[model samples]
Target: MGKAAKKGIFLTTSRFSHEAEDYVKGLDAKIILIDGERLAELMVEYNVGVDPVATYEIKKIDSDYFL
Candidate 1:
């Protein structure tokens, strides 16, 4: 078969596992982390739009990088 499409989700900085549980429910997606606060802060870090979704929190997901 051809290459499978990849999907993903993201975590807002300052957010622990407790708050992230809701959005991380049954769906499967990659978690992109917002490393810091303020638009200028995250903007210098990531190359994506950092808006309301980029709240002050964080979440984690598994990956093959460890294996």
Candidate 2:
């Protein structure tokens, strides 16, 4: 099988225990663990299930305009 078929993604609203993490380390298949905090960050970054309420921009006054 291809590498894609040998990989797994495990997501949890909570975190995995240290033992669980160590167990996967020795496994042949690649596994990605995504916990609560990281899951929220990913959602925001990808705009998966989030909405932007507002946007802001900062501006600097041009000194040349005054001259």
Best by lDDT: 2
**What's the lDDT for all of these models?**
0.52, 0.90
After the best TM-score superposition of candidate 1, give how far the Cα of residue 31 lies from its true spot, in angstroms.
2.5
State the displacement of the C-alpha of residue 14, model 1, in Å, after optimal TM-score superposition: 7.6
Q: Give the TM-score of candidate 1.
A: 0.23
Lowest lDDT 10-residue stretch of candidate 2: 1-10
Best by TM-score: 2
| Tens-digit per-residue lDDT, 1-67, candidate 1 | 0344355545455554655655545445544444336445757568566445454667687677677
* Tens-digit lDDT string for candidate 2 (1-67): 2645678999998999999899878888888999999999999999989999999999999999999
List where candidate 1 sits over 4 angstroms from the true fold: 1-6, 11-17, 21-28, 35-39, 45-67
- Indicate the residue-level lDDT of 52 in model 2: 99
